[model samples]
Target: MKKVIISLFALVAGTGFAVAEDAGCEAFKWPVTREQALFAAAPATPSGGTLAVGAAADLALVPVDKAAFAVPPEHAPGEGTFGAVASVAVPPEGAIQISLSGEAWIDVIQDGKAVKSAGYSGVKTCPGIRKSVRFKLAAGPATIQFSGAKKAELKVAVLTPE
Candidate 1:
């Protein structure tokens, strides 16, 4: 009984598994404390097939086939991987950051073209996030796509940096 309990404790503490909340975010090139906190919180489930999300809305996600993309993803998913896309309204701030709970390809498509990333950072040791991508966006709507995900369902967050 003690051995079993110790094993469980070891897994919870750290192992060759996913990260724990507040673990490795500070290592990121830019500060990701806000994103880390939101990711630690229970994610909001999207209603319908559409994805109109706001700050701290760490989403459970919507999986879709590659054929659904009006514009192809910048990086394609490897064999056996999955993908997800969300139409997000970029706030007037003109720049926003999208945080991911898993490793995947991220693309922000607006007006049928990909918006270039303004900043990029991620750490494998971060418990709830695998990476975060920032884009310089116009104040309006954009399509955020995630490809090459090993899992069909993933958690995501889109936030306007302060």
Candidate 2:
């Protein structure tokens, strides 16, 4: 009985590990096209918390805790840029408004290509002025890449029309 129990435990644990491995960030391919990123229809709204990319709502607020993740390659404030990835599911039609509350630039990537980009302009602040970029989005899985001046925290909001 003791041996049988141990074997069962190992099987369960191994299965859990496999599931986790498959869910890792590597599973997502970057720079997908706008069309490729669309969902068949609008998905349900997401609740407040750490922004869940593929499960985010029409309005997703993402917090950039600099201490939480490593900074990506640098770029001029409004020029080229790099940062972390947030998965988002856009509607079949309409536009997504990407806004930043600090010194940061955002790139919307579908199928590993940047479809749209919003850069920062004006004076930088702790909770900086709201800079935004709006573009048409198709329903699907899209990646939002954020890069900006080194700061303790930043807020990013993705808003879609009602």
TM-score of each: 0.74, 0.45
Error of 1 at 30 (Å): 1.7
Model 1 per-residue lDDT tens digits across residues 1-162: 999999999987775344433457766777777766766664465422344445555444344464366578887667777776678887787788888788888888988899889988878877777888889988887887777788756667777765
Sliding window of 10 residues with minimal summed lDDT for model 2: 27-36
The TM-score measured for candidate 1 stands at 0.74
Candidate 1, superposed: residue stretches over 4 Å from native: 1-23, 44-54, 57-67
Clashing pairs in 1: 19-127
Tens-place lDDT per residue, model 2, 1-162, is 999999999999999878756643322222112212332232433222234423222322234432122233234332332234566677666467654444555666666566743322232221223354565766787766666534434445555532
What lDDT would each prediction earn against the true structure? Answer: 0.71, 0.46
